[model samples]
Target: MKRKLLVTAFLLGALLLAAYPMFSVAASSGDVGGLIAESDINPRAARTVESYSLESSHPYSNNFDYTWTITEPGATQIRVHFTKIDVENNYDYVYVYDYAGSQLHKLTGLYSSGGWTAWSYGESIKVRLDTDYSVTDWGFAIDQIEYEGGGGGGGSETNVLTDGVTSSSSLAATGDTEMWTIEVEADALSMHSVLTCGSADFDLYGRLGAEPTTSTYDWRGYTSGGEDVTFDNPGAGTWYI
Candidate 1:
């Protein structure tokens, strides 16, 4: 009788050990983290950061808002591309705001897809997805790039830019020129500047000089929307854009 009882106990223990992993998975699958949770991402600084992807955790819940705020120095504008936007169609949507905290756009699957891209006119953008307490999907992803010179066409009168910082200003477009100056304190493998336009049409231009004027230009760029000027062996000096 005792031998039979020991054999039965050993069989029961083996069966439970084999089934524990399966049971644990089943339990976790139904229990999402919480009703309210937020994720914040701060990228590496000084170096240029070009792209980002964001999503809710597995088994996302309803009645929640996942907000993302990105702040970058030396950033003039941020371009966003929606790669995977699968929300609850009509109700659940993603909202985009500019650095001034103004609503730039509202996106959803009804009008957007994986290839749709948007541009923020300011240095930072806040993205949020709000869902009702109903159905849920896998959420969305946005890839972003920050351009330094605020996109407006460069004008003539040079404005000095602080080292490794972005300055936001306006262009009057009086046919004069708006310029920015940067003094390189160290050697750089490459030097580049970007200009993005807002409303008025202006032409972009850049040059290297100890001092820049309308007549003394080493290089010029002619792009309506935006332009980039790069130098390969840009010896440390003053760069005007």
Candidate 2:
């Protein structure tokens, strides 16, 4: 399939300042990439490394998966700062996870602000990149910072997600789906979600008060550009996407 591919790299941990600690890795098989561990880049109560870059194999390499991991057993909080990012809007993206492997956040062109920043909630961090055979971009680059004693962690919260308020995730390629949970107020007028960001093509699916799957979705939206999936007075409990 001849596709307009976009090429870019991911947070594979590249040394910015000399003597700075970092690591990098790449994977071409399966949906998830193997974790790249580097002699424990997490420091304890000491200023060891500055930043790490997660780069891709090459621009528009078609399909590939890359993974990067940072573990600070001492709860050494980590912060990620995005420098240059352009991931085909949403068709390609990097998913970030907390120390406990929770979906902390995901990034695409829609969420890219002037060097956006995110922090980890646990003692470790995992960044994985999944790309498609379609459009590509210059991927993304992030700087890693560690704080000792879990204090001064640099507002290191990476999840900018809000239920109906305004949050988004990405599906890197075909058969790629991003799932998350959101809270809906009691008997609210309506609870909704939208494809407010990203270029390419993506379908939005939701399951009110249930888990979302490609087949079990209660509400589905396959429209292009600013696709909005709204539910009138949805259940007051938790909703799946």
Candidate 3:
């Protein structure tokens, strides 16, 4: 006899959803944590090939203080992707500020390439470089500015998965939960799901039939980026996750 089950994914905090695949049901627009118009909700933009460049003072001079503002009118959130960061650790600093002039991050020293700042709310974001007279290194560059389109050309996009495919999405605030449904086949041998949280930590939960809660979930993944849930000789029904 083929058993039926539902799986659900719950996030305790903000994070990215990378891959959720199996012989399962596709997530509908009405599903909890589903897509929304960029105008309605300020969701984070997925990293893309398109990029812009802003480099620090050439030769990495000393006593340099400069601020650059990047704006897209009506934009809800803004982010900067750092391609390179090499400055005197702690001595020299790069500051990130939001449109309201509130500080978001202070970075220094060397960081692995492709580091990015958290999404800053509003239409503008400021990046400033402050250096001491004593020492300096290669400095940093903002190679990419990511944000969701207020309208036209950027809207909610959904991914329908068949097998072994990944979909990317981001959640905002604490206790945010995004869910999807999956259907297992009678011949299916196993069901697996993976969640990859970048820079932030999140939790995943799964259950059969109805939505799963933090405590009521049948399957839970508690590791960072290492969260995985698999069922062998699985049931043949819809899973909510």
Best by TM-score: 3
Model 3, runs deviating above 4 Å: 1-49, 151-241
Show where candidate 2 strays beyond 4 Å.
1-49, 58-60, 110-116, 150-241
Compose the digit string of candidate 3's lDDT tens values, residues 40-119. Answer: 22335432223555565434668766565665435677676666666798899888888788998787776535356767
Clashes of each: 13, 24, 16
User: For candidate 1, lDDT tens digit of each residue in 87-186?
Assistant: 7867887787776768776765432234423445555566677888998876655553434444322323334343333434555435555556544433
lDDT of 2 by residue, 1-241 (tens): 2212211111111211111122233322221112222324444345334464444333534565545555443555664544444567667877777666677666655333324235566655766677788876666555545534442334222221232233434444465544445434453566456665445766666676445666887787778754566666565544555
- Measured against the true structure, the TM-scores of the candidates, in listed sequence, are 0.39, 0.39, 0.43
Query: Which whole-number lDDT from 0 to 100 does residue 191 have in model 2?
Result: 49
- CA-only RMSD, every prediction: 24.8, 17.3, 19.6
* lDDT accuracy of residue 213 in candidate 3: 78
Per-model CA lDDT versus the true structure: 0.47, 0.49, 0.56
Show where candidate 1 strays beyond 4 Å. 1-49, 110-113, 150-241
